[model samples]
Target: MKKNILGLLIVSLLLVFVAVNLLTGNEAAPASSLEIQQAESKVEEETVKVNTEVNAEIPYAKDFTLSNLQGEEVSLSDYKGQIVILNFWATWCPPCKEEMPHMQSFYEKQDDIEIVAVNLTSMDVGLEKVKQFVDDYGLTFPVLLDEEDIVGQQYGIITIPTTYIIDQEGRVFQEIVGAVDEQMLEEMINALKSYDE
Candidate 1:
């Protein structure tokens, strides 16, 4: 059932991409096989904001505190004035690793959005392993360790790479269930930023 939903989400995103291209007159003059492939990949890479389009049922993101890599305590409400990407992931997940670099890029590129990477500590090998992973990946964003998995349980994070894009009001604007790309992250942030302005 989850697989079916994910597939549907991808297809929906592709349709949105084509629609945007057509509206903006950004598509190629003559649609070739290469153009078709580019359109699909470009749309997938840019990603689409959800919840309204397909009516994805995501709860209001509740506030929680967790310790970052440096042992400093951080809370979700701490970023009250900014958009936040609350990503739940584990070091062991391949898709998590694949999308993390893009997440890092998004974090670095945007000053208005905060990316707090919550590590499923109980599921990961150890704190040392997480540290090594962070170092190896050059992740500069807040790498939080969910030591007790309490926040994970509260969020009902049954899958790795589950992400919540919270608005300035701390509302869950979108819930992404899979890995996210840099372009997608940029688009979401921009879309929300526009709403605030």
Candidate 2:
């Protein structure tokens, strides 16, 4: 009788162990899968939001002339027949850094679109830092230094990464307050091109 009791106890323990392992293992698998699905959903939602924002119209674009990094004078008037994107940024601003690569890529892709990345002068961020940033990011767009903050003040810039898209007729087509994505920049360029036609 004692032997039978021992056998039953061993079987009961084994069954309990199996049940626990299966329950925990099954629960973990679903949780991991759910987490991955949630992450993918979040990414999709963010992409949609960015696309919607890009498609929206811009307000209050303007024109300005400034000197490039090579100390040569450049004028928005010179590009009168082309779409221009004037971006005001500072080297130290995080948002400025985030949007630069996208700007560079847009500049690379578009032939008729002109991008002017104006470095704000009011901030204490030095010229060396700006140069380093331009080099590190491989920015091919014209980088103008606003040494006296003249251009920035003229545009009423209150923050870094303020962008203005100008039409071919020398009028402001859109004004963006912060760092903009490549899609938005492309949309603005397309809009300006349509205006020309």
Candidate 3:
């Protein structure tokens, strides 16, 4: 198989975009803005401190176990042999909300891929709010709870709606830091399929 060059380049550009987005805070919809309302609703801006430092090099996606709404534990290893779209998001993020329909639609149509919408549970308003968000969005994909932010910290998730597409071999195939539409998602998955062939 060819090296995952497309994935690498996308990740590189996304990192640069994220840095610029943070410094300017002028983007129409920065990924950080996804949960901004929740932040404002709870903490005053004066009390909010932004962490400028992040792990410059994100390691390979690590295996983690998180609970779903059904209270069952799900792990990355369990999805072995299938492609996984591991997404980190929160209920209060607008961009995350913007992207979920596309993700859910793709999940419903795709037979060979698994979509795991990992909710930043620690940052959400409450469990009831997450349930409401899921019900409102009509999402059928497995929604994992990162209640302690452990997986987010491990993945160096500085932004909401951060997505890592893991290939069937359990390798990180691609990473997108912002919202993605259906066409883009389909193209990426198709490219991965072609690579495997």
lDDT of 3: 0.84
Candidate 3 wrong stretches, greater than 4 Å = 1-60
Pick the winner on TM-score between candidates 1 and 3: 1
TM-score for candidate 3, residues paired by index: 0.70
| Number of backbone collisions per candidate | 0, 2, 1
Model 2 per-residue lDDT at 174: 70
lDDT of each: 0.85, 0.79, 0.84
lDDT of 1: 0.85
Candidate 1 residue 17 Cα shift, in angstroms, is 37
For candidate 1, the clash count comes to: 0
lDDT of 2 by residue, 1-197 (tens): 99999999999999999899888885554458888999998996675445333233444344567778788998767788777888899988899989999998888988887898889955747888888899999999889888898888888889888888877666677777878889877766765666556
* Arranged by lDDT, best first: 1, 3, 2
TM-score to native of every candidate shown: 0.73, 0.67, 0.70
Off by over 4 Å in 2: 1-63
Model 2 clashing residue pairs (backbone): 59-175, 61-172
Tell me the tens digit of each residue's lDDT in model 3 across 1-61: 2459888888999999999988988667554764887778556323222211123343456
lDDT of 1 by residue, 1-197 (tens): 99999999999999999999999998657789998999997776555634323234535579999999999999999999788999999989999999998998778877787899999998899999999999999999888899999999999999889998898888787788989888777777776666656
